[model samples]
Target: MRLAVSALLLALVATPAAAHFQEILPSDDVLPEGGTVTIDLVFTHPMERGPTMDMARPARVGVMANGAVRDLTPAIEEKKVDGKSAWTLSDTLQEPGAAVYFVEPQPYWEQAEKKWITHYSKVIVDSYASGEGWDAMVGLPVEIEPLVRPTGLWTGNLFRGIVRNDGKPVPFAEIEVEWVNDGSVTTPNEAFITQVIKADGNGVFAYAMPHAGWWGFAALIDGPKTKAPDGSEADSELGGLIWVKASDMSAASKLLIKQ
Candidate 1:
């Protein structure tokens, strides 16, 4: 029995982490000049900052600007990260309003977890300082409606949102948060890798970011049972993920140098 237990522990350590974050990250949250914005769509562990899984050609890639959706799938370009397949988009929003960018990637099969995962990820970019439409909803199957404006946030500001699935609130929904590591921070243990939290009784959750960088919030929900690779029934994990950037407001607190 001791030998069996030791083998089990070894197997557990060998297993890869299951905290998958689908990132739809923009180069800037608020575009001042109103032009092209670069977006990187990657599937990986943001905090771990490695092992980016290859994503298939997404089912949909588009943006909602000025109350209309524009299909940008034809403009998506394939890229490689850590020698793994990824994607990038250079979309141009020439108006003075907020543009909501979203991506629906193909279902990814995780052989280790024996399940299929699909994450509908989104991020907002306000162009020309036009704050209108910052709260536009993508109407995804599972999504987060931000209670506070996602942009123009400081490092310590609390980000709040309501977890919704099928246009209804999901009370006590689970959420996983991670900061896009800039290779400057290291985790002391496994628990620090992905910060986990749950929604309150009203389907609202909040998290105050501790650092200045891009942060990803993913709300995972069990989707309908789907067919596995081997024609067997398997669990489906549907995620509504959003990416937000926080800035360091030290400039506001700095003493001005005398001219």
Candidate 2:
């Protein structure tokens, strides 16, 4: 019994403190005047922001805006963050509407879990007061369809979405949430690093974000068995991630007219 207990303890100790997320953060989600938007692409444990992983050239990168999908792969440029491989791109906001940028990353070989991880991530940016397309689906393999407007959100707003896989709702799907820690906030323990929640019967989930910043909601599911880098069969983790930025209520201001 003691031997079995010791093995269990060892396994628990080896588990990661929190989950990983593929982050695609933009300068601003709402463009008051509409000009240019710079996007930062990185793969990391956002809350901890350490041990950054090298992201291979993404399999696909594009944007859906103005009722059309545009390939933005040519715009991707290499960047280095803290001496680790990263990517950056810029998109000019020429039209009025919502643009959804998405990335399908090449499967990452995680040696610790002996599984491949692929997160289909995306973020929405609204331009020039256009708000009609914020809820449009990008048709990723796995995705979270937002039930609320993604941008222009207050800090205490509740985020709601339906976890979908292959155009179908995944009932009782598991979701993991984390903030892009800018080093201002500190967590008390491992549990605070990643907040976990689940969808209901309709594959709908809700999370009330208490703080202001970019919050990532990832709907995780098991993908088809695939070969690892070593040519051996391994499990795959497919994450449907969506990023939303929340602004502080105190930031809103009342305009005074000159009498």
- The best candidate by lDDT is 2
Q: Which regions in candidate 1 have their CA more than 4 angstroms from the true location?
A: 1-8, 11-16, 251-259
Q: Give me the overall lDDT of model 1.
A: 0.91
- Residues 71-172, model 1: lDDT tens digits: 999999999999988999898888899899999999999987899999999999989977788788999999999988888889999999999998899999
Give all TM-scores, in the order shown: 0.93, 0.92
Clashes of each: 0, 0
Model 1 per-residue lDDT at 26: 91
Q: Model 2: residues >4 Å from true position, as ranges?
A: 1-17, 254-259
Tell me the deviation in Å of residue 60 in model 1: 0.2
lDDT (0 to 1) per candidate: 0.91, 0.92
Candidate 2: residue pairs that collide:
none
